[model samples]
Target chain A: MSPFILICVFVVAFLLGYRIISNVPSLLHTPLMSGMNALSGVIVLGALTATTLAGSPLSVLLGAVGVALAITNVFGGFDVTHKMLRMIEGKNRQKRARPELLDA
Target chain B: MDATAYNSIAGILTLAVLYGLHLMSSVKTAVRGNLVCALAMSAGIMMTMYKDHAFASPVLCTAIAVGMVFGLFLSNTVKMIQMPQLVAFLHGLGGGTAAFVGLVILLDIGVANAFERVSACLALAAGMITIAGSFVAAGKLHQLLPQKPLILPGHGILANAILAVMGAAFVMHAFALDTLALFAVFLLFTAGLAFGIVFTMRVGGADMPITISLLNSLGGTSSAIAGFAVGDPLLIAIGGIIGSSGFMLTRIMCRAMNRKLVSILLGESSVALGAQDPAASVSSAPIAPKPADGENKAASWLTCAGKVIIVPGYGMALAQAQHRIKQLADMLKGRGASVSYAIHPVAGRMPGHMNVLLAEASVEYEQLLEMDAANPLFAEADLVLVVGANDVVNPAAMEAKDTPIYGMPILRVDEAKRVIICNYDDKPGYAGVENSLYRRDGVILIQGDAASVLERLIAML
Candidate 1:
């Protein structure tokens, strides 16, 4: 994709995210924050590709580390977000949800 | 797969991820929805790799396997109470990855175009900022770093100067005027990293929530810029999502706290944390702890009270007293005493800090009350339990017009018929001003670890 198109994509996504995030209740901030962190962990994709394209051992090592951290960020971030969202309730609501980690 | 096909597939998955995430906000289906969202994200990632035919790389496989293993272990090992800190740790890792990725591209691919070079430079600078800032935030939330603002004279001017140098270096690289662009980038990286640390340091506990949110966004923005540097469309999309989400959260947090984003970035949080460090706020102040004054008396008030409200703070979380407080609340409920939690928006060290702790401890959802809801209850309540909290409950916000937190809304703890304060010390809270509520007549003080105090109170009840 061209740089201009990519920038436009980012701008559109950002405004959309602002709307979605703004609509959320105050209490859900923490869980939602963690969830977004999980999304950002998608950078792991680049690291995975970089590892294959790396010509030197040092670059490979860097790429490997990047992949590990990015995956860790994604998996860890989402896992905690799941746990956190389960804990939230507004003025009135509560239900015992099954822990999803078992399913994952 | 063709590039077009790959893009289409990734786009569909991203939408699914967004939809899943949107649904995940609902309390009832959150667990299930989050799982689906996570799975979709994972699928998107895997498909992207497969699109490049890079899944067969042994190194990639090994790295991913190890990351999955460690991530799983971390998820299991880390207690829910440490969620904020864990988020910070992940944010730091994200920044570090961006920096490393930018480094690789700079050392290997060099500059592709003005856009690419600018994005790469931005990624590097942002990575340095987040890596340093988030790590410090984690340390502060974990109490490894002091909660107070660490500032020196002329900090703002120096930080701006460093940024100016970085901008000049980036321009030099873009115009092809400098052969040592790598060195310039490194110079900017070092200075920017230092600025991140000092910048976050100048922010106090009162603004921790904003700081954390801000750092989380920086991590996302850096990754998005890194995506541009690496030419990864999927990374760009997801990173933008995270970035915008975080920024919006930060904006909300600032509004909640009645603070501006510019002041936070300018490292002017000492004032934001609240005014001058009056000597009276210190534990050694003349008001005195009156250790013997209340002497094992906290239990009696709870047993007799018809309504009890608990206001928890960062100290409570630091003391790991949420579980015991939950037990106490249960005991109170068993005794036919009404109980509800009063959560201040800026309570504890971060945004939603007390909420997270209370949730982790299984405090009934309805029982946890926001400031708006809980304030009126204080007047009707027979007893108020201020658990390891200071500033949020401080009467200073209302009665004292000269104090920094004067206009800031505070829980009306003084309105309750009887207020019992359970804390390790008589020290002032994050506002750095003494709570006048302590001076009021008939207030009870229960000094010790909150968990043990609550435990003893529960036993007595």
Candidate 2:
């Protein structure tokens, strides 16, 4: 992308992010952070692109590592976030399954 | 198919699916929403693989496969209690990715314009610093590193010196001095990493969560900038989402702590106070539960208390005491003694940390109280039972004006009639301030694992 277009995208993305994220409650901050961490793993795309067009072994190694790191961020981040939220939602389900626990 | 066309198709598709999933994560089940979000993300990544061109590089595929295996293993094995460490680790990896990408781009395709060169530098510096900061923050949170602030003398001047070097690097790169530009990048990487470590090391544990939020945002922004250098819109948009969310979360956390983002970023809050008073630092042996005789004295008070409010913190999480605490609350309620929990927003490592823990332990949602609700009731409370809490209940925050947390809002559990503390040690809380509430008359200290002690307390009741 051109520098001017990148700047324009940055501004719009910033404003859009501010509006969407402000609506999220503090209670979900950890999950939100992790989810975003996964999304940010989008850098793997750049790494892949770099590798495809690479001219040397050094560049290939760098791009490979970049892809690995970014993809890990994406996969691990999202999955772990799911685990946490599952623990939370599972508790609610547990309470529902045994109503007496709530009374107890 | 053209890469741009594929990217646009995949990007737009991921957004549509994830936006709904994101909404559902908060409104409905986070587990399902998170799974769907992950799936959508995976689809987006798959699009990066150009089918016709074939990434015939076996080395690259193997490296990526290794990463996938590691990520899957990590995600599956990590316990919920250690979620902070996992989050920080992944965020650090993201930063590392951006730095790697920046390096590859610079080496493979010599920058054709000033913009590419500058953006490349920006990505490299931002990524390295974030990686270092997130790792340090994770270490501190996991108790692998010291919790105290790591403020070096003359850090402000040192920071400026680093900035000056970065400026020189920018100049060399702008002039197309290949050797000088490469050296400048090296210097920037080291300096950025050093700066992140230095800045974060000095920040106290209480502020570490905020730092984590900011670092995650930095990771996202760096990735976006890296994407810009590579000329990818999809990466930019995803990075934007991650960056903005982290920034927003940091702001929320700051509001919860009643501190400004500017002050937090400036440096350690405790540094200005200089030396802490030596006399106030003395830790006394716990008052109750050590001897069989001590139980009666504490038990008598619990029986007599008309109302008791429980204040929990990170220590409670460590002890796995939430279930036992819930049992004690139930027994107390059975005795016609009013029982409630006072929750501080910043009580645990994350916002609403205590609530989730308690909820998982089957604590009734109604009995739990927020800061605003619990503070007023503290005056009328017959007793305050503190469970592994320290900094939030430190009376010094209100009375001692010179301390870092002086202006910060606290649980005000000291206003209650009497206090009882259950913790593993007397080493104070994350802020490193002595809890004057522990020193107060009529307060009972039960120094044992919270679960075992709470179990004994339940048996006594």
Listed models, DockQ each:
0.47, 0.58
Task: Please give the RMSD to the true structure for each candidate, in Å.
Answer: 4.3, 3.6
TM-scores for all candidates: the values are 0.90, 0.88
B1-461 per-residue lDDT for model 1 (tens digits): 77788778767776776676677556666667677779888897778678756678787888888888888788778876677878888888898888878766666656678788888788878888888988888887666876556777788998888788878777766665456776777776887698788777777666788888898888988888888887777678778878887887788677656667897787665252445552223323234445543645767777888898989987688679999998988888898988889988878655677877888777766677878888888889999998888877888877777766676778899898999988777766666667888878768877667787777777676
Error of 1 at B73 (Å): 2.1
DockQ of 2: 0.58
- Assess each prediction's global lDDT (C-alpha) against the native: 0.76, 0.75
Q: For model 2, which pairs clash?
A: A1-B231, B150-B201, B150-B202
* Candidate 1 segments whose C-alpha is farther than 4 A from its true place: A85-104, B143-147, B271-297
Native-vs-model 1 lDDT? 0.76
Provide the lowest-lDDT 10-residue window in model 1 chain B: B278-287
| Regions of candidate 2 where Cα sits further than 4 Å from its true position | A99-104, B2-7, B17-27, B51-55, B271-297, B300-308, B330-340, B359-370, B373-383, B424-428, B439-443
